[model samples]
Target: MMRPIYLLLGLILSLAGLRAQNLTAPLLSGSWQSTYHNPAMVHFLPQPVTLGLPGLANDLRLENLQYKDIFVEEGGRRILDFTAWSDLVDEQNTVQDVYSFETFGLAVQRGRLGLSLYHRLRVEGEAQYSRTLVDLIALGNAPFIGQTVELAPQGEVVSFHEVGLGLSYALTDKIAVGGRVKYLVGTSGVQLAEGGSIQLRTAEESFALTLEQDVRVNTVNALEYERLDSFTLDYDPTRLSFSELTGANTGLAFDFGIAVNLDRLRLNASVVDLGASIDWTEDVSSFRFTGTETFDGLDLLEDLLRDTISLATAVDSLLLTYEPERSTAGFQSQIGASVYLGGEYDITERLTAGAMLVLEDRLGELQPAVALLGRYAVADWLQVGINLNHRTGIRTNLGLHLYASPGRVRVFASSDKFFTLLSTGNTALAGVRLGLSLALGQRAAERPGRSRSSFASLP
Candidate 1:
């Protein structure tokens, strides 16, 4: 029972770490976009509480994931939920845990074609904390076992800075075809922990061990030791410092994507990100706690150091030790699609209403989501818009878009959870959107002699 409890505690912590992984793979069917127009940068930044599109007009290029609905059909939610919890234990052993937030995207319209860009921010990951803890445990024992322990530990934080340039040509009034070339720049900070430690428990307790280090990790140095002897001793608490146990390095990486779309119904497919990798700068750290071994049993001092040294060595070994000037990192996957449903309708002479059903794929899994968009022309100079979005579970989103023009200013905000949930602070999201977009370019056709049709002509 005690063992089960320890295992349960470890499992819980491990699953908590999985929150980071869940944050990395984003789905397009969420409602926050009405306020920010993008979901790629959702990890690090707060939702765009304000829209700031009014100042200038130029192209903003940005570059930018799962499945299991089958179970939902067969009442598999409970099963999946149980499995997800069990899987959390398995995930605990993995070396990387990635999370993301603040995802936003935008597209520009030009005649028959539209160009767009998006980004995924705050993608961070590191070697499992449990592995670090384990490594420290083996280090305290030395020659009695006449063995050495080695591990290759690594970690990093990266953002998928993506740039996509798209072109669409309208084949007819209601039908069009388009494609885009996507580019990704991966910026990351990395750390690697590697080293070895040995301990002599007792002569009669002759146990020898050697653990092979993983090849992918770049460990700067290894600890070598020969045990002397053992004796009883009191524990000492003065040797721990947080600073010596950590280090970090920074760098960059790359990826590519291509997508295509059609009219009121858009079939957008692309390799979300391709050929992403991480290159780390080297930075190293080392930890040591020395004391007399207890002959009367494991000394309290020895036991504490045993625990401390294991953690210290693992952390120091895995962190950025060499500290390169910079490093690079990112993830790669195959092509996926988002089928967009246009939600535009005229409710009255001065009002228009629209909605969209968004279906998308991430890393091979499919997700279906829906959105509602409404615009009311309060006057020639002012317009008010509202958006409602829903995807999986009971999560619902609401957004408001307000525009005041001459200079054409826009302010917006949205909630990613039910209003009641928000009021109770049960969800992670809160607040409104406020932003502005200015039309800085005028077409020659809108000047005087040229008709608006000239600008509207098929591409």
Candidate 2:
């Protein structure tokens, strides 16, 4: 029975799960892709009619954990080492990944009104964990004899497709406002519900193990259990039906944005996924767990990770002591939201410098970050930019963004991990956005020495 506690703590952690702010997406200016940053951005687009062929973007963030910080070379082989990185972990660490695609989209501009209709598919998931848990697992409980280490691993994943209608209007050529209404079709998912978590602590006397469990999980064909020892959390568990994956759930969300221009200075503000929530109603189940037990032998947890005890033995032993309660019920969950506030100053006909303040809601906590960036148009067909973003006690990130428009076809890409491409990086944050579209309109003739990339005010 005591060994089961070790099995729960030692191994369930190595596996992976924040939303990262988009600092460079909007700088491309005058493209269908840029409008996603802030719907009001449509007012500054150079083309009259923009048709989105198809495009997708991925934003990823892993805080307080980095590959370079955890791995080292030993005997010509890469070894798993956490000696230099564990202490730097935050009280509540996060891993967020967001992927979105604009399947079919269209934007039309007329006099003072801009209208758009599009279908976007988005899949977002995040995991939030406590640093105390990592410390206890890596350094063991000897560091604090009288203190109690309390922590739990938490995460959620959700997928959905949405059809959105957006509208933008210019009060004056210098000021524009926009909003979007989205109807979401919820898909299959698994999420740790609110008021659900487990705490583990080690007592000084006998070095006893005290694990307090309080876990409630909501599922939509993502989790199933015949018994504690017989369960599956895989993507397709054979129990999932098509109705649960296609239209078993539903949600609603709204987005609003405003863009203002004053001479060479431009200001933009927007909120995404505001008041977004989904209700899982079909093929749903809830698992409720609440209990506490004190057993001697906190020191045996490390050995549990080794082959000393078979997993079957540990799980069966755990079932003898702990039994989770299960029921058929529906639960509602929210899709987190983010707000962006930024301003840019034109340094030259082809250069713009800006700063952005990003605020994101993780579960229920508010996290703030800042970005400083600049964009330049090398020529009418190419634009490039650089960005530097920072967070306290986490890490500093540097990135690049680019946009190219050859004739009526437009393409763009952005990343916060120029130092770490794809999934490789020494920093705590890595993100990339790539997409392509076609601008269908008469190309604006270039003015003498002025650049077409210049977000010229609406005429």
Candidate 3:
């Protein structure tokens, strides 16, 4: 019951946000994996067949907050601390979360047509809040003795699996068009309704607090609540079932892209995750908290120093101060979407440089980012590259990428925020992509005078 809420509050307050970029993946035009960012890149997939084994890409875009601001070491133990959040919090804040893993994949070419099939797991998380919300909860009513605090706390966590099919056709050597269709199976989620809110007011004369709540939250097999003398909700994320993963929650999404190839330059554009929404129709619970109560009870600072309560627990209790109206209802939620416009030029037979502008819609806001990348094909079998990015949360992010096709086996790894690997406490964004695969057919060769190899060529 309360434990789930407490942990959830901790998650939002200590959020490590997500903003992802695969700056190098898309630059390998001849590799089948490059199509992940832009479906049209499929047109360049090396002849006959390319088989994918296993891969994962985890990208994060952190803004306005860091790991240091959320947790502190105390009494030889690490605990969630928000005591000084007033200086660390922003007027409005949002965090986006996503993780992707490809389980299996295959790509085949027939003349000017290319087809691909892939299965992947996708996890998404989101949370939004106002500075006043954190301040009132962490510091309590003393600072707001004569003032009113408006609180807006929103968060969501959802996970699903997708099986997809993609197709691309090269209308000409210089132009290509492609699209992908995905079938999704949702496993679990906890999400808030659009524009939910709460308010608290402390009287100037008596300092009494009046609290109001008007928020709706939805759950899809995310929590199991038990009511006894005390309240508890058993929440164990590890308890997963294969059958439920492929159960009643399902949806479809599409991705489309176009690529234009010039003698020494390439122009690309794509809209990814279009109409990407999931229908949560099973084990669904809806909660509506629209009540007003005279709030009394917890003192945050005294309770903590006395080792009696925590800020997360206090806020958890505050949320349940009023009973909520519950129902069994189903709903739909859309995944975040992004658009990319890019251009790359071949500086030399072995060197390529590129730039891209991206606009993504996350939590009802459009975030913009720009990236520059340079790659070198050292030989037909080895390739290396680097990327520099300027996005909303960070000023500059340095990246490294490497892919080697020694014989029929291909090994690859990349990152646009390699700095985060050194210290998560110092960097706001952290991400990396690792992959291993095989290409059994014609081992991607070049024309007598042209080279399309990502790695340094091996005789």
Candidate 4:
């Protein structure tokens, strides 16, 4: 039990090293990747043909906690300490980790019409809890004696592969609209519903406790089910093979966006990952506990504080008092959704400024963020920009973006929190976004003496 907990914590810490969506990608006007943020931007691609190979584009975000919360300096050394870390946790907290990678991408444009297709893999996980739960594990329930430690914990993990088709067209010279349809193949998932809690109260010279738990774990592969079964029988999970790839779940989703061009100003808006849900129907299992039991005259508190007994031993003894029922059932999980709105102004022939607003839903809560941007076009082959952003519960962060269309190949990269790269200490946020692609056909905005009017037409 301690090993699994440690492994989970290690995984979370490692994932925290990478962070959120490409909030600055849309500002790279000529790059094909811009379409990912606002599909309508496809109409603004400088090249007529674009092909992105596997591992070219990636985005990740951490919704809760930060580097400092997971990695801390103790006694002149930095280490992963959950017990020390629990002191920084809020009374109510939610942790969300999302990762998306483009496996294959392509885009083609002719005059006012544009088309795109891409394959991607996305994994998202979220956990919500009350601080009391953390204290139960980090400091033990000795401090909350005689009080009900209300525990309402919920979490879910889902991974799926997606194939998306997008289409965009210019309506006159000022407006363009686009939409994408995505087909998803779910590979794995686990969800915890609301039905568990623990209450510990200390009596005169002993401790009394009540426990209740109800949870469900789901997966696409039958081997995962066998692994859980093996754990219940022999407490050995290493025998489980987790490399199998099988499609046992499926779903559909869509994205809609529009961009408007007006003289020296451009406005854009889009809603992505809307109406996405996964249904787990294969290799499903559910466990539920609904009875109450009390322990009397047990020196559980002293043993817990003194390390005289292991937490697993204490839990196993309690479980023998009342066991939970295990069964099989199907369940559904929803994907995180987001909305983006942006505007940009051409201050000069070689300079532009912009602002964007983003609203993302995580764990049934809406998280809002804003960014201010400045870009300089050094040449037809090079462009650079900086973004200053602020998101709820996070400190202001700076980001950098570079788009280089050197010869027939294009390369681009952006990070929402670039300053973290130079920090020797821990950061509150971190992220990286980059991609490489081959481009061909006439350069749409590269004609000699073409006025800035054409270059500023869309953003």
Candidate 5:
């Protein structure tokens, strides 16, 4: 049937020309739970009782956001729309490995003063396709009519489903701070066009083949789709099946924190999540553009003037080229930090062993990693733990935590970049983080039969 309508109009004009050469580039900031730690999980919180205002405290932490094999050895692609045609093809760039979201949080204390509530959820799937074979010249230097072919583009499929919320405060007990406000609801995708079909072979005698089509299709009614997860626009499977592009000017993000504790030997430092940015104006009530022209022996060619004034000048030249209405009011920014050290010397008298050393910093040029936590207690409810995190190209996370009896049900497991390794340049993400925590009403009356000598003689 006309070669599947010219291969579906050359795969929708090479997915609108690789989304206009990947909207230019430069936009991959940071901040997404800092990959792990300081997520307020506070070592799986549940040990604070001085309500009578002695050390002042109120905290809550729940963990479960496992990440597969994060950065799978720089293997496992994720987003490379086009490194500007990477020198014609040596091949590299196109991966959006999806799998994110499964978070919940809440923290409140009143001694050193503290308050927190954070939530992040995501659902993304990506796909990439490429094909190139272009070489066309002479548009003003007559060389030999009928011999020019071009179709420089490959393939793509982007999907991002989202949900986020944040709030944090901590002025003491080691310094604390926070901020968050995000909503990306959902988004769908499909993009394939860089150089898929362009054939031109000439031996003269009566040859004829000329092609230099630069198709155009633009749409960027931003609601925040490139910073802190922002994507919406569904239904378009040849007539509709990816419609859900939500917008009404919803985009604003922020976060900051700093924690520290050094009791003469044991240590702890913090600069938890810190991200704030927004710039995505909305106004793209459905765009349109389609082109097709085939000729081999003449069956009827020649019909110019594509549609909708070249799709509104390709969405106003891709919003003036990558959110350029003067830097879209605010480009992108994110920061992260964490450092910890633990101590405890005792092998008898009920047994005890502890160890901790962690260092981290994301967004600021990327590159920083170190994690190791260990603990063991034989009796009195039993306790055992171990956690190791490493990043030298991402990937390397091991975990195991078990605290039975009176510990209000604690069990954990990990291995697979723990939380999809973050920083040092994200490469999609791996997955796994199952969790459950419940200790209602004043933390179940301070568990452990609540009797530290009858509340230590009623305070």
Candidate 6:
């Protein structure tokens, strides 16, 4: 029905406005959250024993679109403004939304050896669409008569739970290495298969439109399909259960990192979420549509508006013309993977500067990002830093990070795009990371050979 289609569109727009993972979290010196990006960072944390409680250590990123793209001021009031959006959007845009939560986590260190265990929940979604699709939605086929409008919008949603174990060791005073192995359980997923395309061509004379489409919706524990003794019914996504979000498939993943400390300079590198895949076998379903049809634009619109023909009936007619199919079969999905390299130089006892390069694979494309960072230790218990970033399609972004330790308790937070928080217009990307944990260990000043173990004292 039209209601479901509208709901899906609203959900996509909301999800597209957010993104995930804190690229700056790993730069914190004494926080256990740093180990998330580079496990070797455990060697630099001041805590010998750390406990991360639930609802903490959260990271989210939303990119590609902003507030100004969706709303505009009209008659002194803000209103949904698709015209404003059309003016800002490009021919092709990709939206990414990701969120992660660390439910329960712990890390312990003994001499040169460190160990960690944690459970996490992660949700990721992405959408790629052409401007023509938006134009068709907002302006309708009348304005697009005599031309072909390509509709190739595609996206996927995935949710999974992970249990991970990490090990780190100092091979030498100047070198440390670490790796994490994770078991992944997929809870729910929806993806669009390849060979899917759509085109709408409207004739100038009669205003008749020809619709051609080939779409496949694959699901894992996110839909229900029935096959009776005599007849088989199509899958119903609306009947999915909440238990699907707990997990319906299984897989494995790993992260590897290494750090080098020398004089006033330090270097670190990591490969994260590497080679992760989930196999959806239980309750899997695939629904497909492949056909071409012609309709008088005016008649179709009038019937849709007057309720002469139900939306479901019209869709059914289209599918019946093509002999739509459904299948219950297992399939595989890969996780988004990333690599990071960073270096820092100590300019003074309380001041340091660094640079980082992040290479991430998204939608079959490699996106490279660079950030220049500066941090100052205001006190033994307080550290703050700022980052200036540059990436494709994004010219500049200012980010901030803060870490405070008060009475053996550590609190850390960071954002990659802080400008979005200051403006009411949806014109920029934004993200935030926050965490709280208890630290138990000898003070940095009381430890023996503190200079040899401290990154700030490398010189």
Top-lDDT candidate index: 3
Candidate 2: where is the Cα deviation over 4 Å? 1-21, 71-85, 141-148, 201-203, 236-246, 306-321, 422-429, 446-459
Q: List per-prediction Cα lDDT, in the order shown.
A: 0.31, 0.66, 0.68, 0.62, 0.29, 0.66
Name the TM-score of candidate 5: 0.27
List TM-score per model, in order.
0.41, 0.83, 0.87, 0.81, 0.27, 0.82
Q: Residues 280-341, candidate 6, lDDT per residue (tens digit)?
A: 88778786656777877543433432223232333343223334578888888788788989
Off by over 4 Å in 5: 1-116, 119-207, 210-218, 222-282, 294-459
Tell me the tens digit of each residue's lDDT in model 5 across 355-394.
Answer: 4443434222244545454445455555554556554333
lDDT of 2 at 190: 68
Q: What's the true lDDT of residue 81 in model 4?
A: 48
What is the per-residue lDDT of model 2 for residues 60-149, given as tens digits with 9 covering 90 to 100?
666876646655666675544434446667787776666676677888887788888887667667767677655654565666455665
By lDDT, rank the candidates, best first.
3, 2, 6, 4, 1, 5
Report the candidate with higher lDDT, 2 versus 4: 2
Report lDDT (Cα) of residue 176, candidate 4: 83
Span of 10 residues, lowest total lDDT, candidate 4: 233-242
Give the Cα error of residue 421 in candidate 4, in Å. Answer: 2.9
> What CA RMSD would you report for each candidate?
14.4, 4.7, 4.2, 5.4, 18.2, 5.9
RMSD from true fold, candidate 1 = 14.4
**3 or 6, which is superior by lDDT?**
3
lDDT accuracy of residue 22 in candidate 2: 55
Give the alpha carbon lDDT tens digit for every residue of 50-154 in model 1. 222422111000010011210122333221222222222321233222333333444444555544454333333333333322333333333223333222222
Model 3 lDDT per residue over 1-459, tens place: 122234346446433532224656666666656777778776555546778887877665546765566667776765656555556767887766566677788887777777888877777777777777556546666677767677757777777887889998777767888999989888877787877756677777776667666777788776554432223333322233456655888999898998776766777799888899999998888777686666444444234332234553554453344456778889887887888888778898878788888888878778887889888888877878888877786447798888787878878888777876666633224667777778766655651112442211112
Better of 2 and 3 by lDDT: 3
Pairs clashing within candidate 6: 18-62, 19-61, 19-62, 20-61, 66-426, 67-426, 68-425, 68-426, 187-247
